[model samples]
Target chain A: MTSQGVWTPEVVADLLLTAESSRTPVGSVTGRWPDFDLAAAYRTQDVGMKRRTARGERVVGVKLGLTSPAKQRQMQVDTPSVAWLTDAMELPPATVVPRSRLIHPRAEPEIVFVLGEELAGPGVTAARAMHAVSAVLGGIEIIDSRYSGFRFTLPDVIADNNSSSRYVTGSVQVNPDGFDLALEGCLLEVDGQVVDSATGAAVLGNPAHALAFAANQLAERGHALQPGWVVLTGGLTEAVPLAPGSHIAAHFSHLGSVVIKAD
Target chain B: MPTGLAGQHDSRTAVLNAEAAERLLAAYAGGEPAEPVIERHPAADVSDAYAIQRAQVVRWIAAGDQVAGYKVGLTSRAMQLQSNVDQPDYGHLMRSMFAPEHVPIPATMFIQPRVEPEVAFVLSRPLRGPGVTIADAVCAIDCLLPALEIIDSRIRDWRITIVDTIADNASSGAVVLGGRPVSPRAIDLRLAGCVLYRNGEIAATGVGGAVLGSPLNSLTWLANTLGPLGVTLEAGHVVLTGSMTRATPVAPGDRVSASFAGLGSVSVQFAPEQQEAAR
Candidate 1:
């Protein structure tokens, strides 16, 4: 076996412990392996961190970011990236957070799906991915870069878990067949003031499309959707920044609403 | 007691070892270039790539995957030449990536997540065939709403070729909708303005006309583009034509607002982290 094959759960656990204890941003580890593939770096990094979680850390839903066309152009890429989620980063709906913990953070309204079975790739199709879903809910994803300037290239961000920080989901589920998801209104409010607005259709025209795209993407990489996997699908609106004493609300037209507070 | 280490590399359980090699090769030598590489091939072959991609998509759909919808890319002229493509290309959006409300998302979700102002269209009628006009596209719309598109890139350092991105679905990402829903005939979409703000501060600005000189133009082009493929946009689908302006990054504890002139306004906020702050 190659030296890289020496990676083990213990190694991953220790790395997560080190990162958490030292609070060292993964960016600092960059030159340590200059030839490391960015995507592989992310998976390797997660392997270490995930090892800790497997020992008792709660697994939260995965975080989906880069749900914008302009961003894809800016990054010179055509596909979005994803990261693992853990319960340690979850916040209740309308929960207020402190402003000082993040270097840069933004919140976006997104449609979340819970898988009823494992969805994996190679031959995974959009219909198969949808069939694996058990429920759908409205949620807000908070993205933050541990990097100081919030100016990472695509590789930097990928290694940083796509800058996923915290997520808050509302308590509602709509069967995949129930609503016209592609065309639903989404209203976001801050401090009782309407700040941003759009519709579910804005995301590649509908949230379901994001699923199809993601499913194809994972399949291309030989990964399939597994049961119980919660995919963040793409964002349904523009991302808003987070600040203290701010209240955010997302009204998903027919689906329902999600509320959060920053204190 | 074990056998020789030779050829043992094939028995490794790590998925990364095998995948990384292929990804690296594809990145460097395969048809998929990691960055823009000028190939002196005929224009016909360049265009043929689109057909090839379409065939691949059809195979997947026939394999039991549904065509959830379509994503229109390079609607802007600037984006057209940036990737060295003379025209725009399309990709499929599936159902597996859809997200629902109340699900907490970790911050490390995307490669380079950013938000752009947009306008979304829900068609009341189907659009098909050539000779489709902007007026036809507009007439088919059910409602129009202000939208924020969260775009991300899958390539490292956000470096990619247009063909690579086209295969990746135009880098389409998350989308947020707000503002009031207005009928297609309500106002002059071209004259509309889209002003975006972060933390109550103006971050980026744009106008509807920026989207291929009126969002309807995007649909018109999209319809014509799809006609050759025997694809027609069905009713009840949302069409996000393109962005009205540049995208901006969002942060936690921050609020974002987008104002579309003559339509209405919308907003959202990100939660804060007291624990990290308490440290």
Candidate 2:
């Protein structure tokens, strides 16, 4: 173990990458790192993302976390946060999740925004942000926290890339034009039983607003959301822990549905 | 006595028919005031009022006037109280309703005209509702602008009821949009302020929160209300949210301007009736 408050961004990034690849849980770095804030966590994440890029993994887009007020309150955070997604993290819809490779995995329902144009913003608005969207769809995120007991502070989670493991997008693609996304209702089921249900409004009162928040946040890092990128707006309901041989399905009103099986 | 009672019922039915609605709309299009529809048909409900308004809009569209967008009226508590109606009303906006900023408007085009300062939304994407929210509305908007809605009452003597106004397409007349287009993100719209000027003097001042808490809420209400009716607020459509203050009447030669804190200003002059012939 490294000395307290002495770990560099490279050291932190390597530790996280090693934990993920070896399917092992790691101790929380929050107490050990001096002045470890969101900015520092993002720097560690950037280093890890760069390493992934060097390993033949291409970034697809981003995933938002704690966008819903309830989720924010549950996490004791006031603002939404983000994580990176890559092509290697995609799981085909209805495909069984690789349970052995994940530790204490959970699933969440999300509204996906597929960009049609580049979206950059220091000042992004819900309306202006939506102009770049090509389509909307339903999605499910499989989050596997590398921290023991799924415990961590906001900075700790940020350094872990918001616990992102894999994602599955629905087949149905709908033009977002004229669709009342706020009112888009969703139902999440496990083992053919309803576990959670919510509307798109639950994601920051509107999924587009969540997308706008993501764009503004990305702009802080001198990055822009590029076309063909898929953004998961965040979980609309409380995430449920995944179990072996359990099947999950999320039904989104107007946008259709997505399913995942864990084995 | 029985014969007289039957005659009254026949007259009521005729007054509620499509022909009566068309005749009333014709008077409106001709800029001629007529008897209030409620006086003619005392039992006309809100749905009947909407039917009459729809009939007039169909005729306007047939006459080559494109549907520009829609508007929400009586959203302010003051307007609702002044109008003596508890609920808000809506109307259709025609392409002709748009007037150039800083231009003179023909006084002969309306019988009894009034001006109200308003906030306008330009949509970048289509919005349909039964469940639209403030966030959804904000995302659908492209920009915001200062506006003035010139409302005209087609009913003679300005004696109108909810049904009468509704049948008159919520008394929609014309709109003057400001030159400046501001992105919705730059300002806290609920706190946006405006000052109305008549002849370069302050007439009234109000904030965006006056319109049902915020203008975005008004748009949300419109989307949800129009969604089930098979109407969609399309991209590029301009929506006039209800006025922020009580409307002020305008006469020939009157110059009215309204300046918004961040949206700039829009002005219009009611040209003398004699100038109508020259144009």
Best by TM-score, which number? 2
For every model in order, the fraction of real contacts preserved is: 0.00, 0.00
Which residue pairs in candidate 2 collide? A126-B139, A127-B139
**TM-score (chain B only), all candidates:** 0.72, 0.92
> What TM-score does model 1 achieve against the real structure?
0.46
What lDDT is obtained when candidate 1 is compared to the true structure?
Answer: 0.62
lDDT of 2 by residue, B1-279 (tens): 699999997676655857547767777668778888877677787788888888888888998999988889988765677778877889999998899976788877888899998899999999999888888899999999889999998888879888888888998999999888999998766545566678875555555666776788889988998999999999999999988656789888899988665678889999976787788
| Candidate 1 wrong stretches, greater than 4 Å | A1-34, A98-101, A216-223, B1-279
Candidate 1 per-residue lDDT over residues A51-144, each given as its tens digit: 6487786665565566566577787877777666777677876677544565556788887888887766555555676777788888888877
In the order shown, the chain A TM-scores of the predictions are 0.81, 0.97
Cα lDDT tens digits, model 1, B1-279, are 346553363244123222332343354233343332112211223344454345545555766766655656676555765777766666565443333322322223444556667787878889996889877887899998776666655445556577556533566555556747898888666645466777765565545655665678888888898887788988876677787666677654556667776567655544444532543
What docking class should model 1 receive? incorrect
Each candidate structure's TM-score, on Cα atoms with residue i matched to residue i, is 0.46, 0.49
Worst 10 residues of 2 chain B by lDDT: B201-210
Superposed model 2: Cα runs more than 4 Å off: B1-279
- In Å, residue B60's CA in model 1 sits off its true spot by 57
DockQ of candidate 2, scored on C-alphas against the true complex (2 decimals): 0.01
| Candidate 2 local lDDT, residue B119 | 91
